[model samples]
Target: MNKYLRRALAPLAAATLGLTLLGGTDAVARPIGWTAAWAASPQRPSEGFTANWAEQGFSRQTLRQVVRVTQAGEQARIRLSNAYGTSPLRITGATIARAGKGAAVEQGSVRHLTFDGRRSTVIPARGHTASDPAQLTVGAEESVTVTLYLAETTGPATFHAQGFTDSYRADGDHRADVSGRAFGEKTQSWYYLAGVDVTGGARSERPGQGGVALFGDSITDGFGSTSGADRRYPDALADRIDRPVVNAGIGGNLVLNDSAWYGERGTARFERDVLDQPGITTAVVLEGLNDIGFYEAQAAGYDRPTYFPAPRVSAAELIAGYRSLIAQAHERGVRVVGATLLPLGGSDHYGAHAARVSDEVNEWIRTSGEFDAVADFDRLLADPADPERIAARYDSGDALHPNDAGYARMAAEVARVL
Candidate 1:
């Protein structure tokens, strides 16, 4: 066939092959408005609030983590991070499935994941990658299991401490294992797992199936909520909202400073953790409590491995961080909702100077009118009589963090504004 004949035959051949050629590339399982259903902010490896596997890393072991999605989807993918790794990270194998009780997975739901069409790929130092989309169906508020097998030693892994939910590990190649018996050792941290995104599903009422991100510190991380109950404010908000809601909170996180055990500061991480969430239309930021509190704790000589030297941040500086997050989100066309710092009078964080700073910052968040919306968590959770302390009923014995009831109240307030 010559030019004329071949040109004429191309249309016929393409029609018969059921293909709509786009620049001669295949269109199989292409992304359809990916929305982040779940996420975890990455942290440097360190001795933390709980036992973490980062230092020991993994060698010929299968690490399994469970996360709950707030968006229903037809297909899904997982994001793996080597954010703080000094050397290239090699992923030998990985899998995803519906989560079951205690390290177990729902049978017949397992799906092997690939990266750039390969079963294995190397993540460059201080880098990350998302697995190719897998044909897995997950429902809103449902849990999914992700298992990774490291055939070789991965030195000092990057991870998220204070996951609140348990993660399990087993020796050998159990990437596809659905049973809990094999995964006996357990930890309370998420290792090298940054986020889980979904696409190729029904678009929600919002364009591109947009999701909302709840970004904050320990309270948003569900530190005081019963372990594994999924009672974080974001979890509760997802129940009330019509669209997807993802938790981007890190326990002990500061708005103006980074921590070895917590995570990158809110301003430094807002774009990647909140705005970058696939189709995130809005973000509710409830940070800065740690910034104010940690300073006092450090000055008072309270020592903990998770506690770093708290920077002496002024109220204006804290407000600057909030302004930065708002501006960045606005640039992305994502709405920003400001939240007041919760009361701290009864906690170790409360000092006269810290109290004055908190009051000033909270007032700005309430009155600045710079944010698209505001959630006055301080006024809402404050004791009516004292006004400086969290109400006894809502306090989780820590006096700083809220209990499950308090989290529910917070969700209601956020929903009312959002």
Candidate 2:
């Protein structure tokens, strides 16, 4: 056996991932149940990897965002977040629909969304709200569009920096517009929209008995995957399985430290992002690369001189972070699946010392048996000849992220453990 793998493979052998994690509606079992079909961990507005509307905020503009849901349902609800807002977020109107090309929506699929029996509501600073359920039949892996009309001068918006799909903008109230023509401007980040939940018989078609929440960083966020392709490993895994898979990945996120560019550390946000998610029976964690890579990249002069507060952490500390997350997940009866950090050789994030720390972490993830299950991605993606760098076929041009094919393999490896 590889030195990293445990002598006893009992945990690794549970490929079917037998677990009895389920939720009851209204604090009791009901015919209709809710499942988080899609999700995005919120991040504080800041200068990010690309141009976005975070700093400028929005005023008298309609924002249309597209997201892919991994579960099926005839009735759905949306969650909006102002987790980082300085003042209350005033929304004049909102709508949800089956997405058409670009900013457009499928005719007749559009549903007006109301919050707490009202068409409009205010989300207090650092708060969020969920819309009343709207009727709209949808299938697994369907793309949904959410349009919000911000009639007031909303201060800096809380958003997900790497949405992986185009978000359209129009100058006025276009909440009910099915023809995307009025929406001219676009960005690749999600503004305010946090999650999409589904319930009803249509969910019977979901791949499995319950949903799996992917809690990780950029790799899980599908950074290098083609925009609008929905080719993230989570998406690919949702395709292969019979259960819903919601992504809680935030690009550039860390396991041990909070970030202005990224979101909160894993331990700090685990409850809201993972535990609080509806019908989350399992959570797969694959983070910590940033905690290990941040300082070395800065010292090597890889740019982002302004990205300070870059605290260096030891491998042991990173392992402890994982332990904290694992304990929390298990307490909620959510099975925890741990993934090895990917090979980082030849990237700006890599140095001799950084490589050692990554190796130490991966070894523990594979052999420690703390996680209910393990997906050995390092062994699966590492270049056989080099053993330290990612295989050329899997490495995106930047040497940091994976291409679509690489994401596919990751999904396959994860499915084996699921």
Candidate 3:
């Protein structure tokens, strides 16, 4: 018996027995409901990674994107991340409006944030942060617009896409305004603005139910997705699914134990990111490439200075680790899905040596059949001519991350299975 399993089961079995003995059945059964999940995409828009550039005429200024709710009467929350920066970001103000366009050209008390009595907050670059709950009285299908203002930036920002669809031009170094008018009416924007918390409310709505978790790496985390596009696959998929889809992807996450890139391995964060989620029913895990690619990229007899080390686990080791993860999820009654990696043949993140590891890991993912369901993202988006390469059509020019269109393809593919 695996040590982790032994430990987990013993306590659970004991608790179950105790409950049975002590009339635990008297406890109310909490209905499982879904929450809105959103994540930035790994693809970059035509303006490049930075949405506010001097030449682009949109820099220094902050932008706003509003997500109006299509379904009303449910509670909602806002989540934010500066997941791709090398430094910290200081936000001057963040606001939620009644589905308005632009910054409102003003700030008001109506702004609901994930903070305690504060209009401004700071987010560490390369890390993620969630806002305090903002309660609102919404109708059956109303909308709420969220606007954010930042002081400084070190790297380009990435965001989930479904809520707001308009673009922006940075005003200067200190400001940017929402561009044009909302794509209102028939726009059918799919990304979320405020996440519906639906955990506690009148049983009348019967909102609580099983939720889907977008469990994976940066792709699920929205690493390369356009800043304002809200086109990341997870966001796209969330818009398509009627149930809640929470984004649990962390940038640079790996499947097997290796070095720490973003605090801990994805497996280590699994309990917190997936199981601990408020109400998650299904989990789609898209990981492993980082372990394979990073491992293969290491120097034959040298060490790199970065905190993250590469390709530590062999193909067999990763397979074993994956099986363990699947078993764990199944034990908890959560369905586990595996996503084959996109090609890395030309990514600056990959080298010839590293490429081999990616290939090996991908092959195992296809044949292992360990996952409850498989999301063959590699085949759907990878270049057909060069099986080991991301299709040019999908490549975001970085050769590793997908473009907006590519992410759409990914979202469509996964939606089909769901």
| Index of the highest-lDDT prediction | 2
lDDT of 2 at 190: 92
lDDT of 1 at 59: 92
Best-to-worst order by TM-score is 1, 2, 3
Q: What is the alpha-carbon lDDT for the whole of candidate 3?
A: 0.53
Write one digit per residue (lDDT tens) for candidate 1, span 1-418: 2222122111111210111123445645422446678888887887555477888799999999999988888778888888899999899999999999989999999999988778888888788777877889998889999999999899999898878889999999898987889998998889999888775455443553357889999899888988888888889999887778888898889888877778888898886777666657888999988898888888888876556777888999999999899998887778889999999997989888789999999999989899999999999999999999999999999889899999999999999998
Residue pairs clashing, model 2? 206-242, 207-242, 207-243, 208-242, 208-243
> What's the TM-score of each model vs. the native?
0.91, 0.91, 0.61
lDDT by residue (tens digit), candidate 2, 1-418: 2111111111111211112224666354234456788988888988655679988899999999999988888888888889899999998999999999999999999899988678999988887777877888888889999999999999888998888889999998999999999999998999998888877645544434678889999999998998888998899999988788989898888888888778788898887787777777889999998888887888788777534667778999999999999998887778999999999988878997789999999999999999999999898998999978899999887777888989999999989999
Preferred candidate (TM-score higher): 2 or 3? 2
Regions of candidate 1 where Cα sits further than 4 Å from its true position = 1-31, 203-205
Q: Is candidate 1 or candidate 2 better by TM-score?
A: 1
lDDT of each residue in 1-418, candidate 3, tens digit only: 3232232212111211101112376765332232433322211111322222211211244455544332333344555544444457566666554554443333332444645457666666544444545555554233455555555443544333222244332333222223333222122122112243432333223433355677776677665678555566676776676655666665556776634333356666576456544445577878777776655555543354432445456667777767777877787777777777788886655666556656776677778777877788888887778877888878778777887788888877777766
lDDT against the true structure, each candidate: 0.83, 0.84, 0.53
The top-ranked prediction according to TM-score is 1
Q: Once superposed on the true structure, which residue ranges of model 2 sit more than 4 Å away at CA?
A: 1-32, 201-208
